[model samples]
Target: MKIIPLGIWGGYPKANSATSSFLIEDKGFHLLLDCGSGVLSSLQNYISIDELDAVILTHFHHDHVADIGPLQYSKLIQSQLNNDVKTLPIYAPNHEKDFFQKLTFNKHTKGKVLEENKEYAIGPFVIHTIKTTHPAYCLAIKLTVEGQSVVFTADTEWFVELGSFSSMVDLLISESNLYKSFEGQIPGHMSGRQAGLLAKEAKVKKLILTHLPHFGELNQLVAEAKQNYKGEVEIAKVGKSYFLSN
Candidate 1:
């Protein structure tokens, strides 16, 4: 299984990175995590957006679901021109049920939307959705492929029980948006130190910090996380793909 970071910016506007989005692929099948504003452009660098099997949106925020409409349109056009039966499966929290239904083309069309705490399977992966603390309806996902597992914590704060969701995963793709100075006050997003603490508690093999803030010293943030966690940690880089085998 491979996880590709489409964009890693915490909130857009800065040029360092885009918003939150990722592509999780195994063999020829592809599953996109969050299709944010910058996702469509970034996706062209890898595979055609129309070829994706499904999209799993963690929340309904702009930085997360902004590209869904465009991607859906592109796929619709492709399906018509190429005589393709390709359909897009969207899984999101209950809060987005009505929103996605309204945004979807064709009133009679059906889109697969799931509430948090539900479990589903896509291709070779078994996915479990967990609720997370965020302003909008948010979720963290755990995906198990083959014998390895990876947990993606999308825009969450330091919660004591978060480790339970990521327990013994091969890779924990957690956010490290703010520095220690803005710890508890930041509300929804977690600091680098907080993510490290969660990873340590979960005993994950590797911690991939992502969704970096627009401004501030990135080196300092990584150093802070290292102080709390003694495991392998790598900041997620956009346009880069990580192949995982355990």
Candidate 2:
């Protein structure tokens, strides 16, 4: 399995960067993790939008779902060029009915509601979702392929349950949105140290810090994470790929 970071910034995009998008591929199957601002352009750097097999949204925040409209339009254009094109399947939380309804405005996209804790099979992956502590209804996703497991903590505050939820995974892609100095000032995001502590408790083999804020010094975030986590830690970079082995 391979996971590619299309964008790593949080809340909004940084110069020449985007907000929260990832591409996970196994064999020939492609799964998009999020479609945030400026993601459509970044996605084309790796694969065509129409080639995506499915998309799973973590939440309805603009920074997370901003590119859904553009992606749908791109698929619509592709369908116009080919007669047998199929709608892209998008799995998202069911609470935001109006937002989900808008995503299905055209025939290019098919929106499916994701029920908490239910397992869904999408090609080579088995996915399970759990609610996270965020302003909007957000979901943290766990994807298992063959015998390898990966957990993504989309966006959340510190919670005890998350440690067990992500326990013993091969990779934990967590949102490290704040630095230690700003901890608890924000309610729905994790600081670098907090993210590190969670990874340590979860006992993940590898930790990738993502959803970084543009204002913070990147190196400082990694340093703080290392203070709590003694394992391999990496800061997510746009267009970078991490290969997973069983």
Candidate 3:
């Protein structure tokens, strides 16, 4: 399994990093994690919007789901170019269904609504969702492909359940939106140290820290995570592709 990051940034914009978009490829199947505004243009650089097999939205925040509307409209319009084209199936938490409905403009319908703790299979992957501590109700995803497992924690604060939820995954892609030693409580986001500790406790093979805070020294954040985590740690940037094997 390989994860291609289209964009990786926090609440603010950076030079090349897009908001938060990830593409997981395994056994000829491709799954998109999120489609934020920062990744809208970057999507074209990686794959056609029509080529996406499915889009799993973690939450309904603008930075996390901004490009959903445009992506859907482009797919609908492009279906005319090829008669064999199919509308991509989107899976999101039940609460975010209303947002999806608004994006479809009420003309287009038919999408899979995910219930917490329910298992859904897409192609070669088995997906399970766990609730997270974000502003809006969010679902953290676990994808099992072949014998390899990958977990993605959308946007959440440091919590004990996060480690338990991420248990046994080969790769953990988590949002480290804040640097260590931030004087004030940011609320609804994780610091690099917090993410590193979770990864360590989960025993994941690799920890890819993303969603870098808008204003902070990147080097310090990376250093903070490294202090807590003994495993391989990297601050994911845009245009980087990570290859994983079972």
Candidate 4:
């Protein structure tokens, strides 16, 4: 399996860029990880909207779910244009027990709810979720395809339990939205050092710091994470793909 960063910024995208989003591909199944701000415009560079298999959201934060409305509209328009009512399933954590009651517009698009910690299959992937420490309800996601696994922290602050949740994954994509200097100053987000600590505890193969901050030199995040994790550490770059190894 290979994961590509469609957009890397955290709260908002940089000039002419996009906010947090990713694409995971395996066996021709394309999974859109998050549909944040500017994602639709940036996504066209790689795949057409119709080609998307599914979208899994981490949270309802503006930076993470901004493009969802646009996505729904695109799906609506495309199905009408092709005269094909192909429905796209958008899986999100079921904050409610009865999430099937979510918006199901003409079968063009639908909502799928996931119960936290319960395993579910989405195409070629086995997925799970855990709640994150954020203002709004959020979930950190884990995807396993074949023998490899990946943990996307989504958006979270430092918590000891995360170590076991992500344990021994092939890759741990941790959010490094804050710098070490601003460690305690921020809430609901982890710093590069905290991300590294989580990676170290999880014993992941490689660490990729994502949900990047727009300010400060990004390379510093890598440096800080390396201070705690002696493994391969790198910043997530847009349009770049990271292949998982056995």
Candidate 5:
């Protein structure tokens, strides 16, 4: 399996960059993890809109799903051109009904509810979700394919159950959205050191710090995470791919 960062910044995008979005691919099936700001434009740099098979949203936050509208429109245009009108399946939580309803854009995209603790098979992946600690209701995702497993913390603070839930995964994509000094000031986001602590607690083979803060020397986050984690720790870069093996 290969996971690519389409946009790594948090809250809002930096100049010429984007907010939280990742693309996961395995066995020719492409799954977009989020559809945040600039994602639709950044995505074309890697693959065309039609190549995307599905999308799974963590929450209704603008930084996480802003491009969802554009994505639906892209499909609408593509269908008009080719006459191949297959509604792309978007799996998401229904915590906010208004946002959830907008996911269905007639012939372009359709929304599928992702229930807590329920397993959904999408192509070669088995998807699982755990509720996350965020302002808006969010679900942390775990995807397993052919014995290769990876967990994404989405947007969350340090939680005991989350550590247990991600135990022994091959890769942990964590939201390292704050510095150690400002850890608790942000009510729902984790600090660099907190991300490492979770990686150590979960015993993950590798860690990727994502949903990054826009300032304060990005390398500090990697260094802090490495202090607690023995595994490889990297700051997610847009357009970079992290490959996973079984």
Candidate 6:
């Protein structure tokens, strides 16, 4: 399995970067994890709109799903040009019915409700969803392909149950939106130290910190994470790809 970080910024995009988005591909199947602000432009740098197989959203937050409208319009244009377009299946939580309806407003996109703790097959990937603790209803996703697993802790505060939900994964792509200095200041996002603790508890082979806030010094975040986690750690970069093999 191959995973690429399309955009790593959190909340809003920076001048040159975008908000949370990742592209996971396995066996010629392309699945987008999220489509945040400016993600469509960044995604176009790697793959055409028609190349995408499906999209899975963790929540309805604008920082996570802001580009759905643009992506749907892009797909609609592609369909008009090729006349062989298929509706892209977007798996999302069912709690926010109004938001889900707005996302699927375009004819070229279809929204499917994701059940808590339920596993679903999407091409070569088996997806498992875990309800996460956030202001709005959210989910943390696990993708397994050929026995290799990759877990994404979409956006959540520090929670004890996350360790079990992400146990023994190959990679843990966590959202580290705050530094250790601002742990309790924020209520719905994890700090860099918390991310490291979760990775250590889960015993993941690799940990990549993403959904980064734009204010703090990134090296400080890395150093803080290293203080808690002793394994390989990397700060997510846009357009960079990580591969996992079983």
Candidate whose lDDT is highest: 5
Residue-by-residue lDDT tens digits, candidate 5, 13-112: 9999889889999999999998899999998988889999999999988999999988998898888898868779999999899889989989789999
RMSD of 4: 1.8
Better of 1 and 3 by lDDT: 1
lDDT of 4: 0.87
lDDT of each: 0.82, 0.90, 0.78, 0.87, 0.92, 0.90
Question: Over 4 Å off in model 6, which ranges?
Answer: none
In the range 169-215, model 4's lDDT, one tens digit per residue, is 99999999999999978789999999999999999999999899878
Residue range 55-118, candidate 6, lDDT tens digits = 9999999999999999888888887889945889999998989988876745688998898899
What lDDT score is found at residue 96 in candidate 5? Answer: 92
lDDT score for residue 33 of model 1? 89
Worst 10 residues of 1 by lDDT: 102-111
Candidate 5 local lDDT, residue 215 = 80
lDDT of 1 by residue, 1-246 (tens): 999998888767256455878889987889988888878888888888667887888888788878778877787777778866655677777675577674456521236766677788887889988888888878899999888999999988877768898998999999888999998787899988888888889999989888888788887777888888899887888888788886
Q: What TM-score should be assigned to candidate 5?
A: 0.98
Number of backbone clashes in candidate 1: 0
Residue lDDT tens for model 2, 1-246:
999999999999988778987999999999999999988899899998778999999999999999998888888778878763687889999798999887674677888888887899988999988899999999999999998999999999999989999999999999999999999899899988988999999999999999998885888888899999999998987888898886
Kindly indicate the candidate among 3 and 5 with the higher TM-score.
Answer: 5
**What clash pairs does model 4 have?**
none
lDDT per residue as tens, model 3, 1-246? 778888888664577557877888777777888878767678777777766777888888888888777876776667656653565777887685568566443333246687778799988889988888888888889988777888889898877887988997888998888877762377778988888888889989989888777776777767787887898888886677787675
Alpha-carbon TM-score of each model against the true structure: 0.93, 0.98, 0.92, 0.95, 0.98, 0.98
Query: Candidate 6 clash total?
Result: 0
Candidate 2 contains a number of clashing pairs equal to 0
